[model samples]
Target: MSYYSISAILTSAQKVPCTFDLPIPNRGFLDDNPGGDIAAHTPLPLPLYLAELLAVQQLDNRPLLTLDLPSSLQPRVLNALKADAKSVDLRGQEVYFFEGAARVLELLEEEEVGDGLCEAFKKRAAEIADHARNARGGTSSGEGGEFLRGLDEWERGLFRAAHDSSKAVRMWMGEVKGAK
Candidate 1:
């Protein structure tokens, strides 16, 4: 419903004067008003679509926090995005790759890899992530495919840990429910 309304507003804005007097509703008594304006009409209707688009533009223009991600991680993310592009929109693909790259940085930070080792690890992780994001969709993994393979191995380890964690939580919940 909101999507349709947004689409309608965008379409409407593209045509005609692109302006409308949308009502502003407020809950207050008509009398005893602070500004003496009608209680239900204290505010004014603003340009809806233009305002929305401007807000979205501002969000998209913000700098990414993954700027410091390792060079190695960047390639791995790229490879993964490329591989998954067929199943995702451009923006979604970009977001997935960016998120994966950030995750690599987080792992390194948490592990507290020393400066020299950290630089090396970061470089390797960035490369791997970027390559994964850039990998060909429905095509064979290219020459740098091993980097992606390493990422796959890393994810598998995380998956195992997550699976165990979920199982433990589920069992704990079951025990609590039985107690009740």
Candidate 2:
């Protein structure tokens, strides 16, 4: 996806009501686009939930995105992730929400290095909320939300890196004929 699209997604994501109460970061300002700036969104610090939501959006928008994957990687790797690809049959069309989700979870697995994101997310999410508050010059009411947030830069980077593959996003598009 283009940088601009990322910005747009984030902007819309704010409306999605993340389980975590972390505030949405601004889209930034650019001279060219006075209304809003996509480039200004750089150095972006996206919370895990927001990123997942964006990943979901990206997945749902593409019907044929899965076709780009190497046919060899289909069943051996994608299906190995364990869930069946039933978007079209079930969700009406090829909505890759689940596939993108699987890949993002895979990222957490790799980055946490078996430490497991569950514990880390519970601990770090609060810290991230603190960091975001500090950056915004806003005050925290000492209230926390239900869902977790707050992945550090390294953690956030890993979460994002995994989603870089459309292959991962569309893993459920339907396994390759002979890919086992």
The best candidate in terms of lDDT: 1
TM-score of 1: 0.23
Q: lDDT tens string, model 2, 1-180?
A: 345755333333321112212222333331233455343123333443444544344323442111112221234433322242211121121122222333344433343322332443334434433433342222334332211122223334333443344334355444654375
Residue pairs in steric clash, candidate 2? 125-149
lDDT over C-alpha atoms for residue 14 of model 1: 27
Which candidate's TM-score is highest?
1
Which regions of candidate 2 are displaced past 4 Å?
1-26, 29-34, 59-112, 115-180
Question: Per-residue CA lDDT of candidate 1, range 16-56, in tens?
Answer: 11111222234123234444433322232223333333223
- Candidate 2 TM-score, true structure as reference: 0.20
lDDT, residue 1, model 1: 17
Score every model by TM-score. 0.23, 0.20
